[model samples]
Target: MEYEMFIKKSSLQQKMLISFLCLIVIPLGVFGYISLSISKQTIEEQTITSNLKTLGLISEKLDIMASDLTAISNIYFSNEDLRKILMQPSVEKTYEERAKKEFLTKMIINFKYAYTWLEYYTSILGLNGFELHTFYDGRVEIDELKKEDWYQEAFRQNGSIIWVSDPSPKLARTVSEEHFVSAVRVLKDFESGAPLGLLMINVNESFLFQQYAEAMKDYDQLMLLDANGTIISTTQKSLLHQNIKDTKYYNQAKNGDRGSFKDEIDGKRMLVTYHNVKNTGWSIIAYTPFDKLFANIYRAELLIIIVFVIVLFLSILVSYFIANRLSVPIKRLYRSMQKVEMGDLSERTDVLGTDEIGELGRKFNRMVSRIEQLHDRVVAEQEMKRRSELQALQSQINTHFLYNTLASIRYMLLTQTAEKVDSVIVALVKLLKRTLTDENEYISVGEEIDNLRNYVYIQKARQDGKLEVEFQIDDRITHAQTLKLLLQPIVENAIFHGIEPKEGTGCISVKGWEEQESLMFEITDNGVGITKLETGGAADITEAILSRGSGMGLRNVNHRIVLHFGEEYGLKVFSQEGEGTKVILKLPKFVKTEELISL
Candidate 1:
């Protein structure tokens, strides 16, 4: 209401000033505020998504690595030669019996070095209590490995593989200072289900960091935490193996939320994002200072505000000057119009100059002089439109009559018989006479189907009784009015493309029903389907008529249906290779009325 009052009270010049100011000032203010809000959020979200994507890739890589290790372990477990050598009693072997042992040693070494990620491997056999190591001293007893934490916990899993991170004493014998991520699996006999031994594959910790080093450059800190919230991997090496369950964003990540937040961590305000690595049940967390992440948002807002103030002042001054220049001329023209409305034809504005206002005055005077000329042309155009409509109606009637007469003649010539030919002649005569007399665009569905049946009878004789046709029209839609001649062309196309191309007997079925306030027609045929002629899409009827091997009758029929009704009431085709074709016709379910019949 307040806005309506302002619109009423404001003059053209004043309103122009207000509207111009609003168009510039309001949008500028809104865009500035929205940009400031969106910029920070967009940047933060992009950072989080980037980190999450990197971590997800690393987790997948880890899974693949674990799979490779398990595959290698399965290889050794199934090695019967190694199993037999390990199970043999020491008293039954000597220096000459070391062939299997030497070959097994070389095989493990080749397996370890073949995979770039595999740093070391160990197999602790429980049969004869012999320990085989890829990079460690090969003489270690199996009883010694039982003392390790990873070995004890792995056996507790009962044959399943387990991942143990940052193992003590490492696995690279020469570099005990370096930490490793180990996969431990217990091997069992394939047939006996008896525990054979334990197999371990150790991957260097530095190799995991190398995979995501480029992505970690943007953050001040990065940590990969296990399900227990213990730091398994970190850029800050000192924090490795430390518990992070007390961290501010740890629980949110564990709870499956991936986003950034501003919070104080270890005495500094930081923006942090954490995402869970689904395969490993570990969280990858990235942190940067709050000021560092959103510094651009603050600077952008300040710059936008400064520019907005200057532009607002300039817009007000320019709009007021331009509005006054334009509105003054219009106001003078309004006064002259008032004089002319009072029957003063001689009245004219003396404030005319060589501008748009002067041209408007000149055109206004000329328009009055030519008013009668325009009226005469309008009447002439109306007469032309009426004649064109009448010509169109006459042409449709003549075309239908000519087709029926020609079809009747063709049927007579093909049969070479004058006896018992009166039925075809009588149907053609009635069809031609009816088409010549009726000018209505729409006819009852039953009448159209009857005319179609007559046409089909003639076509059957022309095709030498090769066409098999059936109609399953619903009684509910028999009284509904539809555009005339809608079904004949579709049925003809089905006969030529669908029926004629097949070897054995082909069938054409026409079905009609009412569906969703529309009249639906389905013309289906079992023949060498339309797929051989063209692909399955609505064939452009106009183009199809000109292109050889394209369906001919389909385009003409679709064209007439669209002309009488509209685009929404036309043909849709479905065909399959070597199966069949179905063409559907849609039209409005309108009942015949006196008004429509007269049109």
Candidate 2:
């Protein structure tokens, strides 16, 4: 539950990364594990089978050797002289002396004839002092021979050969017999049914071990055991003639002809493959250390695990990269949206692509731009309503200008004729009546031009005809609605700052036209133009005259124009120090208040 809760709270990148790893890494890990396991099992089974085959080959070779031994023992049966010699009565001691010499001579001749064969020391111990021996120049007590283990065991086998290792203390073989494994059998009379003597064939244990020398390893052992689990011939000479250890493998091998088992022998864990030699009724046991047999499989398993880890690590990085691609754009867009929600209309996402996230970011940016446009228009409309009520009282900043105009009329009344004084009075009354009216903010281009004409006329009367005004408005837009009193202040500034300051008569031109979807107006005056001044005074006159996009009057006008329409409709100013000043004011072409309110 806690893990699920943690996952639920994770970021998108984390969640995607986790999911990818689970999908790929878990299954891959399990597959790797299973692959290693199957490889290990297969290798183990193959090795076991291979080792068993090795034991089979060894057992086959040993069986051939055993069969040859048994066959050689049977060869002695065809020797009529040896049989007749053993058949001599126990009471007749006359031929014993001559028989030993003749049998020894026959043994030497036989050994020379089969010199390449597994060399053997032959011997016979008989009843009634009929023994003929060629094994070693040694003697044994004939009275105590009945108690000898070799004699007793051979006698119990009737006529069959009994395999024994290092088996002569009573018969007393030569020094080499200590390392010899021999086959002993009792020879009996076929016609009389009476036992004659025991015939023994001794061969060096090296003969048995040499049969499998190529298959023997330093850590492995090969042994030939009788049906009773006695070690007859073994590579390890010390184990010859000893009873096989009581191991589970030996117990299992004794019950079957050929088989294998895992067990510990002589304190070392090993795999034992055993087979029985049919000719001699002996078992061939091969011991191989368990670890040495399968070391390669272990190394391969380790290497595969390492490769799996490297592959898994690479997959993790790819998973993270995939998650990053999906999550980063969303995060950027979300942050931008948060800023927009907090009223930052300038917010924009830098997320880039042609995917869905990129489209969403672009749509969000467009939506914010539109919202800012609507916010500005709404603010402008509300502010315009406030300004309508507040601006009705003639602005205090214009009081000095009004008083000056009144003084100019007084002067006109005193110095000029009644006709000139009446004209000034009429112009003053006309300007004041229009400026103070509580009407709608918009008026026709003709009415604005007429208003500017009245203000210019009053100024011209005061300036003694030094100022001249010109209008070059397009007739196509003469009846177009525009803001009231917008041009009056511009023309008044031209008279006071441009025309009055000039030594000769000066001209102010007011021109209006329609361009594209906007209204363009240019006001030009032939007077001393604007300059960047530290203390020269008249920067406010420049602001009022040229609409330089700064200061109170023109900046406010530009702000209002931009707010009402968009960023594309604003004011532009160009001025030279001595040539002239021109101001271009752009507004939405003949936009009605109804359209603006609906927008």
Candidate 3:
């Protein structure tokens, strides 16, 4: 219930990923379990059957070798040439010693010429104490040999052929350091029914089962055990002649002629096959561990697990890609909604999907656009109201200038001539046309200079020879556009504050030029400078100028420059007690007329 609740709470992407994992994991489990189960059984069965067949073949090989030893022994025991030499009397044997020695040499030659293996065979004349061997001289006394268990067993059998294992000291054909195993029999004369001599045929133990060791690489061990439970031939040299009668492998072999069984030997699980040779009563046994038997099956199980993990990982990635593709658009839409909730009406979804998510995103973009439209309309209305208030203030300043100029004209008409009055009125009319009218907020530099000339001419009329003015402007910027009354107010301030207080003729110079990306204008006068400049620095002087009674026009010009351009483009004032004031107007050059004309 908890897992189901978790799944229900998960996002669609997580749910899809979990479903994909289930699809991959469950099928992999079922496939691996079933495959390992069936293959394990099939591999074990085939391996056990194959080993049993190998054991049977090894047993047949032992039978053939045992039969060969018996037949060769029988041939030696019944030879008539051997009877003639051994039966000769002692008094006659002395004269026939050469003949006896020749007879032994003939026996060795016959054995060597007849068989490629050349098994060591021996013959002893019991009557004369003479003996001969194919490979080694007789090393043991005949009395001691007769006391051996296999020797007595052979004597008791009389002439019947029997096979026995001989694991003695190591034997060599030249030096005799190696020992030879022999199948021995007592030779009995058919005419007398008495044993004449002993016929011993030796076989090398190492040569037995030499071919089978290389062929049976998968089996852990291949052993040949005699009827007496002695290991005669085996792949392990340490187990030679070792008795295994008490072991489970031997006990199981003793009960059956030829068969296979699965058992635990010395803590190891083994598939054992055994075959008892019919001729020799010897058992051929093989012990194979279960791990070796199921080697290929284990490798197949590892391969299955690797493939399962790879497929599961790939399935997860594919599922995650699909789930993320489905959910990312919705997540982006949610984030965009959050931005709008925080008052960002400009936020819009840019989802690329064409499903319900895409429809929702398109709706969101349209809704934001609509909200932005309403916001822009409200902002425009508020801006229009602000502009109306600014224009009303500008009209008040215009009315104040007209009142001061008309007062000066009325005073001039009372005390001066008509020609001078007419020139002042004409200059006032031109100044009024440029400053008071709202036909254009900006004008070319040459037109603004004309406006300045008219205003200066009227000021000169007011103070006759008391004021002097000069215009020093760059001809290159004559066509550059700027505010219409950019310089008139500064020139007026210089005249009244700087030139009017001086005793000598005050000269005013208006200089305009380009400075990098801006237009620079300097209005200077040679007259009494600001007396307040003694009390403070340049900032205080500028504060006094912008905050004084007659400096209102200068402050308004500063405000207009800042409002039209930016804060960086405005008026700055510098003055001293004895030096006249200098006012600089920094303005932009060649502004795109449409951008700020409406503002």
- Please, what are the lDDT tens digits per residue for candidate 1 over residues 226-344? 76787767798888778879865787666664656677888888877776655556677888876777778778777887898889889998988899888888888878778767656
Q: Give one digit per residue, the lDDT tens place, for model 3 in 1-599.
A: 99889978987778877887788788878979998998888877787778777777766676676677777777767778777666754343464765666666786677656766544455453534555555555434355455567767877898775566662332234223243345667887789988776776665556665636664696988888778888877778777778898887789877768777889987888988887889867788888888888788778878888988898889888878987888788788988999998879988888957888899899889989998999999889867854664464446436666677777789989988998888899988877666666556678999999988998887787676788898899998898888766687678778877888889799999999999978899998877887743444553376677777767778888887887788888888888777888888898888559655433
* Candidate whose lDDT is highest: 3
Q: How far in Å is the alpha carbon of 143 misplaced in model 3? A: 24
TM-score of each: 0.43, 0.55, 0.49
- What number of backbone clashes does candidate 1 have, counting pairs of residues 3 or more apart or in separate chains? 1
Name the candidate, 1 or 3, with the larger TM-score value. Answer: 3
Clashing pairs in 1: 541-555
Which has the better lDDT: candidate 1, or candidate 2?
Answer: 2
Query: Which scores greater on TM-score, model 2 or model 3?
Result: 2
lDDT of 2 at 375: 96
Candidate 3, lDDT over the whole model: 0.74
lDDT of predicted model 1: 0.70
